[model samples]
Target: MNFGREAMMTSDIECDVRSLGDSGKQRAIFAHFDSLSVGQSLVLVNNRPIEHLRDAFDAEYAGSYSWQELEPRPRSWRVRIGKTASDALPRVVGHTSSGDLDRRSAVWSLPIQRRHDLDVTIVTLAPGTSTTPRPGPAVDTLVHVLAGTGTVTTELRDLDLDPGTLLWLPRHTPRSYTAGPDGLRYLRVRPHQQSPVPDSDGPW
Candidate 1:
């Protein structure tokens, strides 16, 4: 939720709808919704529950779309409004906290949300620890470093991984991660078309 603007391309369109009040926001939401394809979506960020927006969708797009609450808190109410089949209900609707992190030998990872074309996740690494993400076929991966520092070693070169650093890893690329003295935390965004290829040894 603390990500920079560039990290949230999905929320870029309505960057200023709030200033326009409920009327403006509603117009913007439906306009964006009208522009979506069968699996595309837009992210709406508001501090309050969007009851009116939900009602509008229910009234107009009831059978052709879906709604999922990504963040339900007061200050960060995020909703994913997408164009999906009427029968495709939300499989999960909630947040992923640190407690839900899956502990590996030197890292912890968990899913934030999974929708039609994207899967967001968080990964934390211990200082001095490393990750050997195996090479396999999958969707393109976009990584955003949320905290700390690290080194990403790929077959062709070495790249510094720092806070705010964003990287796009193509499918089947081989890479490894090394946490710095302060440890490392990052967010991974991958396409829903194909799943990420897990590390051959288990952790990635």
Candidate 2:
């Protein structure tokens, strides 16, 4: 919910509409939303219900965007509005280069993209840190090291991770990770797992 100015080609932006009038607010919101390219999003912060804006988007955009409620507070509402490509088209997600990621955080994860049945993520682990071992779900998981170094420990053995190392873990495999001295940055791709509560829809 801490939104600040972003640089060029960033994945997200923010719009705070508390000080604008009704018409001005709508204009500001749509202006930012329209400026976004596919796969980019705008985080809207407002003091009132955005049901009208949601309705307007439904009328004008049809199925070209996604609306998700991020965080709800007693005095403010935070909503994430993401632009998506049409079903028949393809769009670039974002770069996964180590230099492109934020390095200040010791651990972080970025969801690259989510398709009908697939999910992709970029994860970073600080030096010497470790991830808890967990049993994989029914779908297979693919891990590709983008930068730094690490070790992928599976039930069978421990595999070293280098910049180009690609590891595949079958379904139901137990796995964990240990970052090397230089830290670890990797891409993880797997099948999308359905959540009990729908994530894309909010009360609006």
Candidate 3:
């Protein structure tokens, strides 16, 4: 199997394969993103047919997999896999509005005694306004367009984003987004980062 940085970025983030039984039956796990652009795509493997694990968690922005047991012994047969675009299109779960943005996110993974490893959220922007630009603590972020059109004006540059576009923002970059006349809807994926604690004697 051949994998690359670019391929992984646009394709599904993870995969699982296992043998079913002595009859040679095989099972596979597959996940698809809503859109694909410079940083992401609806992940497909060289035209290989895969079935989604139903028990997996579906969040507002991203999906997650449950822990699955693997076969103890490795299969003798050789299997080759390649990266290619998927012919299947993505199905929309629903649209989210700015008012319900924070509460609408679905938690995919929860760790005991620690913060979550990943957090996914869907944000919708109404026409004629923009969100305040703010810096995240320290985590990488991936944004994918779901519906409508918009212009993302960042400190670095202005980018026109429509359906099927993805953007990757490094940790701590100050950024904001605004929607076009029709409004905008997109998914945001980011690693969990704790906020900094303010000193008792803060500066005015």
lDDT of each: 0.64, 0.70, 0.46
Among these predicted structures, which one has the highest lDDT?
A: 2
Candidate 2 per-residue lDDT over residues 69-127, each given as its tens digit: 76566467778888885432444556776442224232333332223466666777778
Against the true structure, whose TM-score is highest? 2
| TM-score for candidate 2, residues paired by index | 0.50
> How good is model 1 by TM-score?
0.45
Model 1 gets an lDDT of 0.64
Question: Which ten-residue region of model 3 has the weakest summed lDDT?
Answer: 64-73
Q: Candidate 3: which stretches are off by over 4 Å?
A: 1-115, 195-204
What tens-digit string does per-residue lDDT give for candidate 1 at 66-149?
666666778767776777863334444333234222222323343322224555566777787888666734557888887778
Off by over 4 Å in 1: 1-115, 193-203
- The sequence of per-residue lDDT tens digits that candidate 3 reaches over residues 51-126 is 3322222322232222222221233212222223332224454444334322222222232112246556667676
List the candidate numbers ranked by TM-score, top first: 2, 1, 3
**What are the TM-scores, per candidate, against the unseen true structure?**
0.45, 0.50, 0.42
